[model samples]
Target chain A: AQRVTQPEKLLSVFKGAPVELKCNYSYSGSPELFWYVQYSRQRLQLLLRHISRESIKGFTADLNKGETSFHLKKPFAQEEDSAMYYCALSGINTGFQKLVFGTGTRLLVSP
Target chain B: EAGVAQSPRYKIIEKRQSVAFWCNPISGHATLYWYQQILGQGPKLLIQFQNNGVVDDSQLPKDRFSAERLKGVDSTLKIQPAKLEDSAVYLCASSRTDGLENEQYFGPGTRLTVT
Candidate 1:
């Protein structure tokens, strides 16, 4: 079975500091990875995908197949970036794009 | 252009009661998904539909949970004889059927509290 693991349940960082939300996956075949963000009172939205290979809102994630990881990173954390982060995987299943998600990590950026 | 829409933002029901949630996906979207998000946990995919047809429902609890997306537009998820463990936020999301590049858009979830 495919699974996404976000080791940190809560990560607190000071504003202007760096942040890295660790995400690891367990899958035998190639996987499509993504990072979803849910802010307080806001619906969950896509932050970025591994295939896009582009940064959104100053956040970027690199797919490391060897490590089976797709860690989301930001050089300078901002208070507005505080939100619930979820690591999701797709393409593991044959039929539809059923997303497998991790338990999620809450990012808290202190000002 | 409009985002997904979900009704009954909050619901409180006793165990064994029945409840249903409605979801209207974005216009022109061909794929729809339903997820269950427990407090302090990420959302889990309960079911997925493509154009009014079930694509994946392996995770959905068929005995107690049921869902349908008729006409490939709106969908409903029902839980019969709900259990205390079923207390969670139900989320509805949609995306185009153009394959992998399309990302899902979510709606404000309906929080179900089973007491």
Candidate 2:
């Protein structure tokens, strides 16, 4: 079974402050991790993936296999960065892509 | 490319009533998924389809929930005898294929309120 865990239900930060949204996972084999964001009145979209190792909108996440964690980090929080963040995991055993998502964290960036 | 599409942005019904939601995946995409997202929780996969064929539906409540993708392009999910607990956002998503890095694109979810 594959499970993603986002410990924070809500994370609040001031503008320009560094932000870190923690995410942890449980999977037996190698897993592919991803972060998806849902903005106000917008559909969920991919933010970043572990394999890509590329940052999007100043946000980056590194997969730590030993810790079973993939924490999203941003150098400076912006008001527009407030949204719901979800962490998901996928594996190849299913023969199809099935993402197991974690309970999202609502990020609130205050000015 | 156009993103995934779903109908009935919102739906309200009494318990025991039936409701259905539709979805149209991105053009050329071959896989579709139905997910149920309860308030304050993440989306949970209810079912998955691969080109009109049922691929995974282990978590779907077969007794009350059913879904189909007839032509491999569009899909529908039907919930018979709805329950209060069923009130949540139903999200439809699609991906080009089950490739190693194919990311799934989501549709603006249909919010269902079971009164």
Candidate 3:
């Protein structure tokens, strides 16, 4: 049973403070990981993926296979960076591949 | 190129009524997906299609939910006798079927409210 877990339902941080949103997964085989974000009234968009190893919007995530985590982090949070973030895993199950997503975490950066 | 398109932006219906939503994927995309996103939750994949053929539909509630992509161009998802718990935003996404990497592009979801 492959599953994604986003422990925090909501996280608040002051502007310019460092931010970290936790994410973990339970899977046996190698998994492809992704981060998606949805801002107010905007369509959901891809933020970044582990394979790309690229930072987007001043955020970066490292895949820690030993701990089964891919936590998203940012050095300095901005008010405009507040949004809902989801962690997803792509894996094979019963001869088919599917992307399973976590419940999601809402980040509120207060100025 | 235009992004995925879905309509109507919002829909309200009473329980036991039937409703349908439409999606038009990006030009030349070979894979399309439908997802359900409840408030405060991430989007859940209900179905996936490669061209006009169904690739995965294990999570779709067949009794009440049905979808079709007739010519591999446009798609539609229908719910007959909708339930109150069925209220959620329906999202459409598309990606190239080359199989190297699946980076899906999503559309503005259709918000469904079943009372």
Model 1 lDDT per residue over A1-111, tens place? 889999999999999999999999998888999999999989999999999899999999999999999999999999999999999998744645778899999999999
Question: Which number leads on lDDT?
Answer: 2
Model 2 has an lDDT value of: 0.94
Q: Let me know the TM-score candidate 1 reaches against the reference structure.
A: 0.97
Q: In candidate 1, how many clashes are counted?
A: 0
- Better TM-score candidate (1, 3): 1
List runs of model 2 lying over 4 Å from the truth: none
lDDT of 2 at B107: 97
What is the docking quality class of candidate 2? medium
Which ranges of candidate 3 are over 4 A from the true structure?
A92-97, B98-100
How close to the true structure is residue B69 of candidate 2, measured as C-alpha lDDT?
93
Give the chain A TM-score for each candidate.
0.96, 0.97, 0.94
A31: Cα error in model 3, Å: 0.6
After superposition, the stretches of candidate 1 with alpha carbons farther than 4 Å from their true spots are A92-95
**What TM-score do all the candidates reach, one by one?**
0.97, 0.98, 0.96
> Which 10 consecutive residues of model 1 chain B have the lowest summed lDDT?
B95-104
* Candidate 1: pairs in clash: none
